[model samples]
Target chain A: MRIVVLAGGIGGARFLRGLRQAAPDADITVIGNTGDDIHLFGLKVCPDLDTVMYTLGGGINEEQGWGRADETFHLKEELAAYGVGPEWFGLGDRDFATHIVRTQMITAGFPLSAVTEALCDRWKPGVRLLPMTDDRVETHVAVELGGERKVVHFQEYWVRLRASVPAEAVVPVGAEQAKPAPGVLEALAEADVILFPPSNPVVSVGTILAVPGIREAIADAGVPVVGLSPIVGDAPVRGMADKVLAAVGVESTATAVAEHYGSGLLDGWLVDTVDTDSVTRVKAAGILCRAVPLMMTDLDATAQMAREALTLAEEVRQA
Target chain B: MRIVVLAGGIGGARFLRGLRQAAPDADITVIGNTGDDIHLFGLKVCPDLDTVMYTLGGGINEEQGWGRADETFHLKEELAAYGVGPEWFGLGDRDFATHIVRTQMITAGFPLSAVTEALCDRWKPGVRLLPMTDDRVETHVAVELGGERKVVHFQEYWVRLRASVPAEAVVPVGAEQAKPAPGVLEALAEADVILFPPSNPVVSVGTILAVPGIREAIADAGVPVVGLSPIVGDAPVRGMADKVLAAVGVESTATAVAEHYGSGLLDGWLVDTVDTDSVTRVKAAGILCRAVPLMMTDLDATAQMAREALTLAEEVRQA
Candidate 1:
């Protein structure tokens, strides 16, 4: 089977690891969200793309589910000592090599998609990874800080501020003008199944979908489009997904999230067994719904979740 | 006393440390060579300037005479793993931080002179370090590689090739069009004594003098311009200075090096005790010459060399 996954950072990367294990024979193409990409110390940093690359390639910090294992923060410490900072973003020495390479390639006139492919050559992440759009698309969050409204880079909002203040708006700046990167539409068009792996709907998967033609291509791909909920029992299983979801006025519930994606783009939806009650409401909204164990507690548990999503996709195709 | 020094990498940095100790209360301004600067992994690596900064600030590796004392190569190893390299250059993690900061500032439109000053804020390297020129001035070495005469970067010749082949020509590529960096000429004009450290006469001090107005400024400054010879006993005290010195048709001897600077710019010259026989030969060329212990074996010994250079400057002033 040819599977296409729209991935974010930790959660999506972890889920993809499971997907890889569950469907070992399947060809997977990952469309990674570049909206979270930030230039730190004049190097391009694609958090989501690196997360997926590192996790799948066995370089990831398994405990944190992001960054490289056995990584040192000497580079970051030195940069801070030089008073160059966004000190909150934890970029390690090993992790910095990725950004340096990517930045060098990009500065040399290679598109981000080409740079991603080159980086993946080292990781051999198994799946082909393509950034959603090569053109810059940064996710910015509008928030009220010190009683004043300001728009901050998504990283500052998420990593630095820890999403402390309420997000008034979440904007994927430049998405409207960005064209889907090469091979993106073709991958979606030829995919047997498309999966959204419990990533932040507002800024992760949502940001990728915001790219001009990507959402339209997936909707028109004629494949079983299934999504696993990031929410379980009215709360995010990981990360502050609810905060950004609130910015888009989506309730922090599995059924609400499924309805937010809506029946037009989603053919199947998976909620955790904890939210089994929400299945009927999601099905009532004209999408096939199933309640399965959605927590990626370990590789096996996550693999089982991936298998469940595939099974649900088969059911949607048959329906 | 206001002292100005022309510096290169390791040798120049070590000599500056001695100078600092020798004249503890002297106002020192160092015009650092930038021709050895190169862009590696898309970051500006200013070897000479950084060497001076790290050496004086107590961050230098005492044994190697360059780079950070407790440096790690994790970033470099990772970069090599990605096959992104001219893998021979030894840039450590902490050293990489300086380049990254500099590259970022330069990208944001800061000139190298300003960037060097900002970097000094962290190192507190005592002297005011100014690059010879803000404009790009790369030293290119013409050599017969694989039996073909080709031009390669100065770093490639010195670091990668280790100056294995004879240097047919040493060209400071952009120097003819490059103007001295801000304050370079002013520093010379106000200098009480200008000293040339025992840096490479061909690439280090010579490259700095190649900047359009700097040599003229020093000569017209009318202050005592005294130089300590890098060559001793008909050979360079350190580094492969002979290879490049030959490219300019100057023999690698204390007398020849003094003649290379000439009496017009150099008022006094210091050679090692072993090269005492060359003092009369240098004096015949119309520049005052002296024989002193020129080895920088330790701090105290090196400080004595600095004191000797200052004493020669006083003698030249009296003459």
Candidate 2:
């Protein structure tokens, strides 16, 4: 089976790890969102890409789910001593080299997709990882801080502020003109199954769909497009997904999240066992629905969720 | 008395530390050469300036006489993992952040001198350190490599190649048109006495003199300018100073080095105790000379050298 998974950061990385375990013989292609990318300390940092690469490459700090394991902060301390500190975000010494290489390649006129591909050469994360777009699409959040409305970069809102303030609006700048990376649309067209991992729907899958041809490609592919719910018991699995979802007027409910992705893109939807009652409502929204254990506790648990998602896709195709 | 010191790295940093102990009240100003500065991993690195700053700030690695104490190299390892191994020169994790901040500031339109000042704000070296120029002035070494004449950056020749290949020519690119940093001329004009630290006479002090008005300012200063010998018993205090001097067609001897600077700028000179017989020969070159124990073994020994240079300046003034 040729499975193509759309991913964000931590949630996406964890899900992919399980996806591999569930379908060991299948070739997996990952379409990672680069909307949260930020240029920091004079280097380009793609948080989602690094998370996926490090997690799959076996270099991730498993407990933190981001950055390289066994990292040091000597560079950050030195930057601080020079008073060049953006102190809120922790950029470890080992992690910084990733940003430096990506930034250098980008400055040398290579697109983000090409840079991501080159970086993956070192990690060789079993699955083929492709950035959703080559264009400069940055995720920004509108927040009122110090009694002033300002749009800060995604990292500032996510890492620095820890998403304390309500996101008035979340904008993926330059998404409108961003063309899908070369292999992205092709993967969607030829994919046996398209799985939307429990990543941020508004920022992850939504950003991938925002790229010009990607959404159309999946819609026209005539294959099962299934999405797993990130919300369980009216709360996000990880990160500040609810805060960002709320910025776009989406409620923190599995049913609402399914409705947000809507019938246009998703043919099947999988919600957590706790949200089984909402399956009827999700199916009523013209989407095939199934209730399953969606919390990825471990590799086995994650594989079970992946199996459930594939089973749900098969049922939707039959229906 | 006001004192001016021409310096390089390591030994220069250590000697400067002792000079501070010897003349705690003198307004010390350092005219650092920028020829050895190199851009690595997209960050500008001024090894000489950093040496002086870290040495005086009490953050220098005492054994290495360079880089930060308690430094980690997670960044370098990561960079190497990304296939960015500039394997020749060692760049510690702590040291990289300084370069990042410097590159950021320089790219933001601040001159090198102003950047040095801003960096010194945290270091508080208690002395002014100025680069020879704000403009780019790199030293290039022409050598026969792979049976073809090619020029490589100074760092590559010095650190990477270890100067094993004989340099056909040594050129200070852009030095003819480069201007001395602000306060350079003023420091020389107001100086009651000046002493050259035991740095590479050709690369360190020679590069400073290569700047348009710096050499003229020292000669025009109505004060005694004394220099300590870096060459003791026909060998450098440290590093490949002898090889670099040979490339520049200068002999590796205290008398020869003193004569290379000449009486045009220097009013007095200090040779190591082992080279006491060369004192008369240096004096014959039309500069006042003194035989002194110039080895900077410790703070006491270095302070003694500084005191000797200062006393020599006084004798030349009174004579």
Candidate 3:
């Protein structure tokens, strides 16, 4: 079976790790969200892509579930000493290497997609990883600061601001004009099943879909497109998903998130057992819904969730 | 007293340290050689100017004579792991900060001179340090390599090859079209003594003079123009000065180096005591000459040499 996953950063990476184990024989392709990419110290840093690559390639700091394992922040410390900083974003020494090679290749005229391929050559990530789009598609968040309206980069909004302020608007600035990266549409067309891992609905999977052709391709791919809820009960499983969900005027609940992606693009939705109450509302919205244990407490626990999503996909296909 | 010094990397930086000690009351202006500047990994690295700044700023790795003290190479090691290299040049994590800040500023449209000043604001190196030109002026050395004649960067010749091969020609690629940086001519025109530190004459002092108006300004300044010979006892006191000097058809000897600079530009020449015999030869060429203990074994010794150079300058002025 060929599986495609639309992924964000840490949460999505963890889910994909379990999916790989749950369906070992399945060929996996990940269309990573690049809207979180930022230029730091003149180097193009694709945090989401790196998280997926490092998580799969055995370089990730297992404790943190992102960044390199034995990473040092001497580079970051030095940059701050020079008074060059957004000091909030934690880019370690090993991580800086990825950006350096990536920036070097990009400057040498390699597209971001091509650069991602070159980087994967080193990581040997089991899944074929492709960025959502090669063209710049920065996610900018509009907020009111100091009693005045202001706009900030996605990273500044997320990492720097901790997404504290109610986001007035969240825009994928260049997504409307972006074409799907070379392999993205083909992966969708060839996929036996498509999964959205429990990542940020607004900034991660949603931002990837915002690219002009991606949403259309996934909607018409004719495969069982399923999604797992990032929300459980009244809050996010990890990260500040509620802060951004609220920006799009969506309630912070599993059923609301499934309805947010909507029945047109989603065939199956998985909510945590704790939010079993949300299953009815989701199913009533014209989508097949299941309640499962969604906390990725361990690989076994995550793999069980993956198995459940795949089972739901089969059920939706049978229907 | 107002003093102007022409300098390169290690030797010149050490000399300036001594000059600062010898004349603490003097307002020193340093016209630093930029011919050795190279863009590696897409960042502008002015190695010589950095040497002067770091050395004077008390951050230099005293044991190595350059780079940040107690530096880490995590960024470099990671870059190599990604197979991004020129692994020959050891730029530490602390040092990478300087390049990153400089590259960022230059990308943001600041000239090299202004950037240097801004960087100095943190270092507080006391003297005014200026590059020979804000424009690019890379030194290229012609050599026979791989059974073909090729011109490699001066750093590649010196740092990579250690100047083991014979040099065919030495050229400062952009010096002909380059104008002296701001305050360079003004520094020279002011009624003061000008001193050439014992840096590589061919690549350091020679490259600085290659900028059109500088050599002419120093020759016409009429205030005593004195130089301490980098060559002593028919050999360079430090570095592979002989290899490049041969390319310019000058021998590596105290007297020969003075003759190469010539009486037109040089008013006084100081050679090591071992090269006392060359003093008469330098004087025979119509320049005043002296023999002094030139070994910079410690700070006091180096300060004494700086005092000797100033004394010789005064002697020539009296003559």
* Candidate 3 interface RMSD to the true structure: 1.2
Give the TM-scores of the predictions, in the order they appear. Answer: 0.98, 0.97, 0.98
Winner of 2 and 3 under DockQ: 2
Model 2 chain A worst lDDT run, 10 consecutive residues: A76-85
Q: Fraction of reference contacts reproduced per prediction?
A: 0.85, 0.92, 0.72
Candidate 1 runs further than 4 Å off:
none
Taking chain A of model 3 alone, its TM-score versus the true chain A equals 0.99
TM-score of 1: 0.98
Candidate 2 or 3, higher TM-score?
3
Q: Which scores greater on lDDT, model 1 or model 2?
A: 1
**What is candidate 1's lDDT per residue for A190-303, written digit by digit as tens?**
999999999999899999999998999999999999999999999999999999999999999999999999999999999999998898999999999999899898999999
Better of 1 and 3 by DockQ: 1
Query: Among all windows of ten consecutive residues in candidate 1 chain B, which has the lowest summed lDDT?
Result: B230-239
The CA lDDT at A100 in model 2 is 85
The TM-score measured for candidate 2 stands at: 0.97
Going through the candidates in order, what is the number of backbone clashes in each?
A: 0, 0, 0
Give the CAPRI class of candidate 1.
Answer: high
> Model 3 residue A207 lDDT?
99
Candidate achieving higher lDDT, 1 or 3: 1
Give a tens-digit lDDT track for model 3, residues B137-241.
999999998899999999999999999899999999999999999989999999489999999889999999999999999998989999999988888888899
Which lDDT value does model 2 have at B270? Answer: 89
